[model samples]
Target: MKKIVISISDEQYEKMDAHIKKGSALNLNNETFSGYGLILNNAEGGFSWLEVDMYTNLDLGDVNWSIEES
Candidate 1:
């Protein structure tokens, strides 16, 4: 597999941090894999979404997947 890095802002980082914690608590953290998803804008600037699961692994390099928000 290939590794690529993507940049996110600080506010997004915080949100993702909270999300992962909640997800792990619920056993819904998808960190055995990494995927890409999209948020779509709707009429009146609303939001819609889509996601794709692209990969899976038993380990995620040197970091713990759930808390590595950045």
Candidate 2:
């Protein structure tokens, strides 16, 4: 399988987080996680991805993710 690396904004991340949580709440939904979810689930820590979402399937590596140190 071809690896897909996506760089999204904070706003987008929040959206994905909501979606993943909704899917997990169901009784039968074991087929809605991304490949990288094995390394980390959004609910367990941070960030989220959907195996069924179009955004997760896209190749969005052009976006620049800024890191603001506090």
Candidate 3:
């Protein structure tokens, strides 16, 4: 699997947190982890899903993720 290190803003994090909690309350085990959840990538934006397992670690290399605030 491709290692995608997404850089999201604090606001985005809060939104995601709430969504995950709601999923848990609804017995959505496939959509929530201990606390973190999965944000899928799709053509038109994506939805939430549970993170099953990480395939690999990301190597930032020369790319800076700090500037990607969204």
Best by TM-score: 3
Per-model TM-score on C-alpha atoms:
0.35, 0.36, 0.39
| Candidate 1 residue-wise lDDT, 2-62, digit = tens | 4434344565556555555554554545444333332322234333222221231121112
Give the C-alpha miss distance for residue 37 in model 3, angstroms: 7.3
Where does the lowest 10-residue lDDT sum fall in candidate 3? 55-64
* Clash counts for all predictions: 0, 0, 0
Q: What is the lDDT of residue 14 in candidate 2?
A: 65
Clashing pairs in 3: none
lDDT of 2 by residue, 22-63 (tens): 655542455554332422224433445433343243322224
Q: Name the regions of candidate 1 deviating beyond 4 angstroms.
A: 1-3, 28-70
Ranked by TM-score from best down, the candidates are 3, 2, 1
Assess each prediction's global lDDT (C-alpha) against the native.
0.36, 0.43, 0.41
lDDT of 1 at 34: 36
lDDT of 2: 0.43
Ranking by lDDT: 2, 3, 1
